[model samples]
Target: MARRYRYPFNGKRFIGNKNSMEVHDLDNETKNCQIDEIKDEHVVTFIPDTLEEAHKQGFDNGAYCIGNSRR
Candidate 1:
């Protein structure tokens, strides 16, 4: 089967922080998300790019960015 997504998951709409284990929605800017606080080292710019994957890896949606949406 063909790949559903491309490489470098960072290009996706959501980004994850390994250190904090929180997922941020790039398209939705929220203060609680604190996207600016993500350090280079903690940034997960590869796999687990989508919220579903992130959550499976024990990541939670940003309180402000993604809100309570589970998608």
Candidate 2:
């Protein structure tokens, strides 16, 4: 068996070496967990492209909404 990684462009991959780690797409079991983790951060919406950038944007948007909600 072989662990295939995404191409070196806009793809993300799991971290591991040969005979050590298994590199595969996010499984269904862990998908919910990941979603839960992000949801815990109060991220109402996020882009599916990049977590770091999109999450930051979501956080910022959340903050803005919170700050202006009373108005």
Candidate 3:
């Protein structure tokens, strides 16, 4: 049997060498344990008197919200 060569960019085949493949398996138990650390990372709410105040506080960037609820 002849070996095959695979080019990442081009799908064309150029015979002779085989590409090495690597497989990574994540440990679910370890991942679950790490996820628990972030369970308490809740969003903080800020009460700004004005929109400008909110912007000054870095909360008006739309990435953060100023409300009584955490979303």
Candidate with the greatest lDDT versus the true structure: 1
What is the descending lDDT order? 1, 2, 3
The C-alpha stretches of model 3 lying farther than 4 A from their native spots are 1-42, 63-71
Model 3 weakest lDDT span, ten residues long: 15-24
Per-residue CA lDDT of model 2 for 1-71, tens digit only, reads: 12223322113322111221112222212432232233222322223433344334432212211122211
lDDT of 2 at 14: 23
Alpha-carbon local distance difference test for all models = 0.66, 0.25, 0.23
What tens-digit string does per-residue lDDT give for candidate 3 at 1-71?
11112222122111111111111111212332222222222222224323444344443222112223212
Q: 2 or 3: which has the higher TM-score?
A: 3
List TM-scores for all candidates, in order: 0.67, 0.18, 0.20
C-alpha positional error of residue 68 in candidate 2 after TM-score superposition, expressed in Å:
33
Most accurate candidate by TM-score: 1
In candidate 3, which residue pairs clash?
Answer: none
Alpha carbon lDDT of residue 5, candidate 3? 24
TM-score, predicted candidate 1 vs. hidden true structure? 0.67
